[model samples]
Each structure stands twice: as structure tokens, then as C-alpha cells.
Target: MYRIAFGTSGWRGILCEDFTFENVKVVTQAIADHVTAIGERDKGLIVAYDTRFMGERFAKETARVLAGSGIKAYFCKRDTPTPVVSFEILRRGAAGAINFTASHNPPEYNGIKFSPSWGGPALPETTGDIERRANEMLGEVCYRELALDEAARSGLLEEIDPRRTYLAELEKKVDFAAIAGLGTVAVNALYGTGRGYLDEPLTAHKVSVRTMNMHRDPYFGGFPPEPSEKYIQDFINLVKGDPAIRLGIATDGDADRFGIIDEDGTFIEPNYIIALLLDYLVRVRKMTGAVARSVATSHLVDAVARKHGIEVIETPVGFKYIGELISQDRIIIGGEESAGLTIKGHVPEKDGILACFLVAEMVAREGMSVKRLLERLYGEVGTFVTKRENITLSPELEAGYAAKQHQAPGEFAGLKVRETVTVDGSKFILEDGSWLLFRKSGTEPVVRLYGEASSAERLAAVMAAGKAFILG
Candidate 1:
């Protein structure tokens, strides 16, 4: 039971392991208690689930727990995207929400994500309290539960479909008019909850869309429902083979992270996408504001901000930090290298559907291919390349890192260390404007090495040096 710890996102664990129904009930009760303590129990909660196995059941159980606690549960009727759930939280002015999703994790895994009334991931302070209370109640099994019908009869459970309202909100955020002019787009939902949320909007806007893997699949087609390059190859191939398809977009299991493929079948890295969109938002849309990014993200965004004379807020690794900026209207856009992003005047939570639609709008309004647009941005802001790799840690290495004994070198990859930023990890900024960051994973015996340089070759060299430094 103590193994049910929260990570950067939430308390995720393998099904039938730490993520059992008993643990879910315990965590749900903890959340209910926390909400009640805050005097928001009357506001009710929006409960949703993704396409993972038993996600609906887990969500229903969560609602039962909330109902048993004398709180109302506004439950989603079908698998709902994370962003949609977040929007519903704000729309209904609910106390908060409990979402059953593991995001991009493998199918064997499922977890609960709790968002506060602000419609963003719960911050550390809130999650920490819930974690402590849940662990304290490990073997208690003292929770109230009500049947679905009874909860509804008692006016504690209300079924809802957030799609219509969520899509209406999205229309105001994305430039659907521009996207309607775009000839064709391909969407790969990865058998997650993004099918209707991402693909339907484009079709509704009169954009010709071809969708793949839109059906619900508990196995996620035998691959983790991550919208990264490795997992989205078939979608890339589909777009590449079709001459009419102008772009390829995809979302993870819960539709909060995005993956993009250019018209030429290039898998544009999320770092590049963030930079490109920052430039687009600033230069094209004339949206005036600073930007925020995680420390592990690329400095290309900084280059764009510098070019535009806009401020850049550097945050820790989690989107929660970035989301904080969005909530405060401090940034025009907030993004991470992990393909999560949300913009100002929107829910603070990451919205892959919105990200994908905005890219389409960029392509249409610019009247150029995504590759060309990227080249244009490079021509203006100069070129920047970034890479990341994970190195497995031995027991000794893990202990050394835990003790903070592993320090950045005076020089790396034949460059002098100009500065070091320790906001989230040891980010050594080299004299040549390159950087190497080493961050330890909370749940695994591995260190993530991030490198950014002026060119691909330099990025490779920096990554190699980072790997050598960590392994040594």
C-alpha cells in the first residue's frame, strides 16, 4: 500500500499490482476527505476515465467513494480526454476532478490523476497531503460507497458528456477557419481517448481528415499509447504515403501530449515544435506575452523569445510548474520536451488536441509545409538541435547521485563550462552556448541526459560527453 506513491504526474502503478481497486478506493477517499476539509464538498467533482483497461470501472469506483463521502460526482459517460476533463472542472466550477488514466504509460499500467478546481494537475503541496493520508489509511478499509443507481437517486451522481462543451471552448482557442482551408490532415489517436476529441473537430471544421487507430483498444494496438517518434511510425508512414495529407498529428492515451509529422514525413521533435509555435504565436498571431518551459526542454524556445524580445520563464521538470504560469497568465505558451503544452486563455492543463489543431492552423495560414515553416523559423532565429538519452544506473551510481556527489565537470565535450543552473537538475551551460543536463528519474534507476547545441553534430558530441560523465 505504501508503494502507491505519486510521481511527477500521479500515483501510477501496474494493474493488479500497486494500482489495485483497494488502493484506488483509498486514494479516492483521501481526495474526498481533502476536498471536504477545504469546504468544497458541495461543489462536487468531475470524474473521468481514459481508454485504459478497467478505466471506467476505476472511475466508477472513484465516484462511489466520492458519493459515499457525501459528495456529488459528475461522471463522464465515456472515455474522456484529460484536457476535456480539465475543461469540465472549470466549466461546472467543480471542487476538483479524479481522472483514471496512466497518460502515455504502457497498457499494463493504470493510475489516478487528481486535478484541483483550477483545472490543472494538483501541485506538490496538495498531492503530498493526499499521499500522506492515503498511506496512513493503508489497511483501514474504512470507506463509504454507494451503488451507481442509488448514488444517482440520492442526487450524488450525475452523468455528463463534456465533448460538446469542450469542443466549443476549443473553437475559441484554435483558428479553425484557417485549418478549414488546409487540404488534408491525418490523425492517429493511438487507440486512446483522442479519437472524437482530436479528429472530429477537424472534420467538423471542413478539413479533410483521415483517422487511424481511432477505435478503443485496451491493448493500444500492442504498443504503449505514447505519441512519440518510435510509437507513431505507422501513422507517419500513412501520412508519407498519401500525397494529399499535409500533416500528421497524434495524441497519447489521454490526449494531453502530442506528436507531429511533417508533410515530408519528418518527425519534428517536440522541442522544435515548441520553439516553432512560440515563434508563430508571437510573430503571426501577435499574441504578446512571455513563454515558459521546463528545464529539460530545448533552448531554441529561448532563442525565439530573445528574437521577439519576450521573456522566458524556466521551470522545473513537471507541467504543474508550467501550468502554474498559464493559470496566472504569465506566459503565452507553456511546454515541455515531453510533448506537453497549453497556452494562455486556456486551461492550464496540457491539451494535445489543441496543440495539433494549432499546428494545422499554422500550416494553413502560412501556406507552406511544416518542414518549410521550420526552415523559415531556423533562418530567422538560427538553428538549434536537442537530444535526450536515458542511462541505466547501477546501485553505486544511484547512491552517488542521491548523495549529490556526481558533479558537473569544469569542461565537457571539449568546451569550457560557462555556467550551471540547478533549478531541477545539474544543467551545465557550455561556453559555446551548448548545454548538458543530467536529471535522475524518480521511479527508475536511470538518469536522463539532455543536450542542446548549435548543430546536430555538436548535439551528438554533447550527448556522448554527458553519457560518459554519468557512466564514469
Candidate 2:
């Protein structure tokens, strides 16, 4: 039996390695035990899977184990995104949801994310319980399988329609009418599940939109399925080649995170996307509340919030922190450096599909291009050049960076280190209003270096210096 380790969000591993049918059964039973421990075992559970290889089959296997354990599992019958499952957990008032997806990981990998009944990602405390139960499972899933017809007759299992409920709930958050009015928009699913909903709103409202990669491919057709810069050039080129196309939106595998392209066909960083939307929502929509952002996110948001006389709260480098704040506080918006975001009174989980629609509506309603909107935001919040690079470190250096080792240099690239902070990792604040961060990727052996510079050259220089330190 392979030990299943949980990341900040969920449990993930390569499909054939740590992730297997036997292991999935073990984890799902553990999840059943977790729900049972909370006195909700017979109250029921929900299961959903994405379009990846064997995701649906994995979801069924999990249900089989859970049902066998006497914990009824509400299985999602169709391929769907992670957020849709999270929403179902809350809407149905079930114990929680277990999703079969790897999020933005490569196609070869798969993962399981446990969402609480509130339709939000599980907290560390709760996930700890599930992990403890998983470790003790040891491939011995003690549960009795009930036939599907028998289970339904016993008032237990039911298949769900994630798309129908998800679409209905979205009307309250997205300006579907305004987005549909935008004449021509280019969207590339990157063959991810983001295709169906995005094209629907536009088509329903008579908006002229062109699409690509709409067909499903389990392998993602040899691409990494991350929707990162290199993986999304096809969509960028589509937007650039067509003069009528205004914005380009792409979602990662499982469709929880989004990557964007402006009218100029340049990928807009997620940090900027969050800040830009925050600016639009608060300034135009008259929403009132504080802003929550991860520590790794750009301070341009802080600048905007300061101008608006609102407080800014910074948390560790995960959406859980932001989501926790949103659940407890009257937060107008919460965002992370990655493309996950949530708004006030909406589902606490991040919704990339919602964000994509809102961004297009923001542009259409104001009669401004995404590039122009970002430029205006820069003018108000000051310029920011964000760059990230990763490299493998020697074992010794790995430990140091993992512990946030600091090297005091008088100046780096003609800019002095003004101050240093280590909230979650090492972050150096430069005198020129730029910063550099060195942090270890939780799931990989590489050390990631991020820098926000005041100029393009300074950004490049910081990257070079960081690469040299990490690779050397």
C-alpha cells in the first residue's frame, strides 16, 4: 500500500504509481470514515470526476467503496469541473464532496480534492482527519457494496446534474447579458471542461464567439494541460489573427483556474487579473468590503485598496487562507497568485469560469479593451513586472531554501534590498519598489523564484540572479 500524502489542497499522484484503483478505494473509504466520524455517514456523500482518463471510473469505484461502507455516495454521472462538484455538496446539504481531478497538473497525473458541505475546499483540520483515516486504510476497505438499483431503493445513492445546477447558480454572479452583447470573443478550452458553459452564455445571448479545442481529448493531445504560457499559444494566436476578437480566456485541466490574453494577445498574469477585477467590482459595482490576497500576489492590489480607503489582508500562499477569510469576514473579493478567486456571498471556492465571464463583461460594459483596462490599473497602482522561474537545487541548498535561507547582498542588479520578510517564504523588497521571492514547490523538487520588478530589464536580471543561485 502506497502512502497518500495530502498537499495544501488535496491528494494527488501519478495515475499508475501512488494513484491506483486500490489506492482510490482506500482513500474513498477513508473519506467515508471521516464523514462517519462526524456523524454524517448515513446522511450521505457526493462524488464527481473530470474528463481525464479513468476519472469517471475512479469516481464510480469510490462510490462503490463508500456505499459498501454504508455511507451513501451521490455520484455525478457526467464529466464535470471541480467547482461544480463543490457546489453540489452545498446545494444538496451532503456531508461533503470528493472530486477526481488533478486540477492544473499534467495529464498523466490525477488527484482527489475533498470539499466540505459549504461548497468550499476542505480546511487543514478536516483534511488531517481524512489523511489519518487514509493512512490506516491499508487497502482494507471495509464496506458492503449495494447494487445501484438497490442503493437507490434503500434511499441512498443518486446521480447528479452538475452542469444544470452550476449554470443556474451562475446567473446571479455573471453578467451574461452584457457578455453576450460583446460582438466577437475568442475562447480556447485547451480541450478542458471550460468549453460548454463559456460558449453557452455567449450563444444564448446572441454574442458572436469563435472557439477552438472544443472536442474532448483525455491526454489533452500531448500538451501539459496546464493552460500556462507555452500551453496556450494556440488560443493567443487565434485572438491575434482575428481583428474582431477582443479577449482570450483559457482554463486549466479540471477548469478551476484561468489564464487570460488581452486584445494585444499578451497573457495577463493572474495577480493582475484579480486586482483588475477587484478594481472594476468595487469602483463600478459599488461593492463595499476589504480585499484578501495571498502574500505571493502582487501589491498592486494593495495600492488600489489603499486608494479606495479599504483594508488589505495578506495570507499565506494558498487559496484556503483567502477562502477562510471570505467565509468569516465581509470580504468583497479574495484572490491568489494562481488564477483562483471568489467574491462576496458567492461560493467560497474559486470559480475560474465565473471570473472569465466577469472579465469579458467588465470590458464590454465599459467599452474598453482588456489591455486598456490593465494599462489604466497600472497608471493608478504603479507598474509591476512579474516573472517566475524554477530550477533544481542541490540537496543542501534545498533544505536551506525550504527553511527560507537568506543571503544578504548590498545590491542586486543595481537595486538595494530595502527590507526582507518571510511570512511563508523568503521575500526581498528592493528599493525600486520591486520584490523577489524564493520558495519551494510543494509537489516537485524545483525551487521556484519569483520577482516583481519596476522594469523589464530589472525583472530579467532578478530572474538571472535567482536562477544562478538555485542552479549553482
Candidate 3:
């Protein structure tokens, strides 16, 4: 029997392998039990999925399990975005939400993401309880499930479409009036759940927009449904080839992560986007609050907070920590370097649809390309370059990785170390304001190295030195 382990997000495994139907039922039952224990079973739970193969089937199965456990299930009529699911959780005051999505992972992969009543990713405590229950019931017919039709007849299930209400919420949060006059904008759904959410609002506002990959394909056009720079070169080419295209925006499989392309065909890094948006929200929108970012994120956010006379809260690698602050109304924005972010007034979940719209509104109001806006921000608060690399470790190095991170060097790359931070990883803040972080994976023979500096040249040197230090 496979141990049902939940990672930073949720339990993910390849289809027909560890993520079989039997396993999903076990996990759903575990969740149902958890809800009962928490005394929130009467509030009902939302069931949603993305555009992956067997998505709706998996959703129905999950709902059946919930119904069998005597919990009402709110079923989405179509494939839904992760953020939209979060919105529904809060909108209906549901007990929680069970989303069947692998996020940006490959097509062959599928998983479950659970959000509690707070409408953010479940913390370790919740997932730990579910995991323990699931593993205990493995390999036994330990779960009961109600058929979809039977559940509906008994009022244990209700179908819903969240698109209209979700878009309406966007109109209130985003300045659609500003984006109306912007020139033609390009959108790439990447064959995921972002098709209507990202493009519909712009179209409804009378903004000229062109969209690609609107049709759903389980294969995701032969690539992982991620909007990263390397994975979205076709979108970059589209923006580069057309002078009429003012900007390009994209979202991942579940519409929880965003990617941006400048008018001149430059792919803006998410790190820089976070910092730029942070500054824009403080200066233009007049929003007042501190900001939150992952420890692996760029410190340029710190510079922006400094300029605005606000605080910067750094959390561990997961977005859940940042989401907690958002729930508490402690930050104007919270972001991860992995392209996830949410605002203070929004649901405590990453909203790629919201992120793209914010970028468009910023461009419209500023009357400048994203590149120019970045250059302008760079001038205001010194420049920063950030990079992340994964280094495969040999058996010997892997065995000693833990020991290496604990022993921090006083000097690295010929620069004096100013501070050593061990929040999520071992980060050495150099005297020159540059920094390096080393985090080794517990399940894999690899280490993730993150580096940031004031210049590209310095970043390159720091990355190399970090790799060397890890190997040695």
C-alpha cells in the first residue's frame, strides 16, 4: 500500500499509479472525517477540478465520498480555476474545498488541494491529520461513497457555475476602466483553466484582446501547463512578432500562477513582477500595508517596502505562510518566487487571473511598457537580479548536504557574510547586499540554489560560487 503523503500543496501522483481511484476515495474519506471532527460538516464543501483528463470524473468521485460521509458537496459544473474554488469557499462560507488539480505539473500528474474555511491552502497540521487517517485505512474497503445521481436526489449535492460571480468580483477589485483604452492585449491560456477567466473580463470591458489555446486539451499541447519563460516561448514570439500587441499574459494549469511578456518580447520574471506590482500598489493605488514574500524571493521587494516606509515579512517556501498574513489583513500583497501571489482584500489564495489583470491596469495607467516601468522602478530603488538553479547531488554529497548547510562560512565568493538566515534554507547575506540560499530536497538527490545580486554579472558569479560551495 502506498503511503498517502501530502506535500507543501497536497497529495500529487501520476495518474493510474499512486493517484488511482481507490486512493482518491481514501483521501476524500479522510477529509470528510476531518471535517466532521472539526464540527464543520453542516457547512458543506466545494468540489472542483481543472482541465486535466478524468477531471470531472475525479470530482464526482470526491463528491460521492463526501456525500457518503454525510457531508453536502457543492459541485462545479465545469473545470474551474484554483482561485475560483477559493472564492467559492469564502463566498458560500463552506467548510472547505477539495480541488482535483496538479497545478503546473505535467499532464500525467494529478492531485488534490484542500483549502480550509479560511480559503487558503491547508496548513501542515490539517494535512498531517488527513495523511494519518488515510494511511491507516489503506488497502481496506474503509470508505463509503454515494452515487452522483443518488446524492443529487437526496439534496446531498448541488451543481454550480462560479464564472459569472467570480468575474463580477474582479470588476470591483480591478480598474477595468483603465485597461479599456489599452491597445490589443494577447492572452495565452496554455490549454489550462485560465481560458475564460483571463480573457473574458477584458472582452467584457470592450478591450481589444486576442487569445490562444482556448480549447481544452488533456495533453496541454505536449508540454506542462506552466507559464514560465522557457515553457512559454511561443507566447513570447507572438508578442515579439506583432507591434500591435501591447502585452502578453498567461496562467498555469489551475490559474493560480501568472506569466507576463513585455511589448518588446521580454519575459518579465515573476520576482521582478512582484516587486514592480508592490511598488505600483503602494504608489499608484495608494494601498497601505506591509508586504510578504518567501525567503527564496528577491529582496527588491524589501527595497520597495523601504521606499514606501513599510515592513517586509519573509516566510518559508510555501504560499500558505504568506496566505496566512493575507487572511489576517497584515499585508498589501504576498508573493512567492514560483509565480504565486494574493492581495489583502482578495481571497487568501494565489489568483493568476487577478495578477494578469493588475498588470494590464498598471500598463494602462502608466502609459508605458512593462520594461520601461521596470527600468523606472530600477532607477528609483537600485537594480536587482535573481536566479535559481537545481544541482543534482552525488550519493556522497547528498549524504553530507545536511551537515554542509548547518556550517555557514564567514566569507563566501571573496565577500564577507553579513548575516546567516536559516528560516527555510541556509541563506548567506553578503556585505555587498547579495545573497545565496541552499535548500536540499528530502526525497530527491538535488539541491535548489537561489542567488540574488545588484547586477547580472554579480549574480552569475554568485550562482557559480554557490554551486561550488555545495559540491565541495
Name the candidate that leads on lDDT.
3
Off by over 4 Å in 1: 403-406
**Model 3 per-residue lDDT tens digits across residues 58-110:** 99999999999989999999999999999999999999999999999999999
Comparing 1 with 2 on TM-score, the higher-scoring candidate is 1
As a TM-score, model 1 comes out at 0.98
Task: For each candidate, give its TM-score against the true structure.
Answer: 0.98, 0.94, 0.99
**lDDT, residue 470, candidate 2:** 61
Score each candidate by Cα lDDT.
0.91, 0.80, 0.93
Candidate 3: worst 10 consecutive residues by lDDT?
Answer: 404-413
Please report how far candidate 3 places residue 111 from its true position, in Å.
0.5
RMSD of 2: 2.0
Candidate 3 similarity to native, TM-score = 0.99
Candidate 3, residue 19: how far the Cα is off, in Å: 0.7
Candidate 1 lDDT trough over 10 residues, lowest sum: 400-409
> Please, what are the lDDT tens digits per residue for candidate 1 over residues 226-284?
99989888998998899998999999999999999998788989998899899899889
Candidate 2: tens digits of C-alpha lDDT, residues 1-472 = 4677888679988989888988887788788878887887766888887778898888877877777778788888777777677677777888888898888777888899988766678888888888888888776745456676776677667887778778888887888788876778887776777768778777877888888888788788788777677888888888888888888877777777888888878888888888888899998898999999877888888888987998999887867777777777578999988789888877777787878888898988988887788888888878887877777776777777633355546556777889887777777788888888777887667877788876798889977866665655
Q: List pairs with backbone clashes in candidate 2.
A: 68-143, 68-144
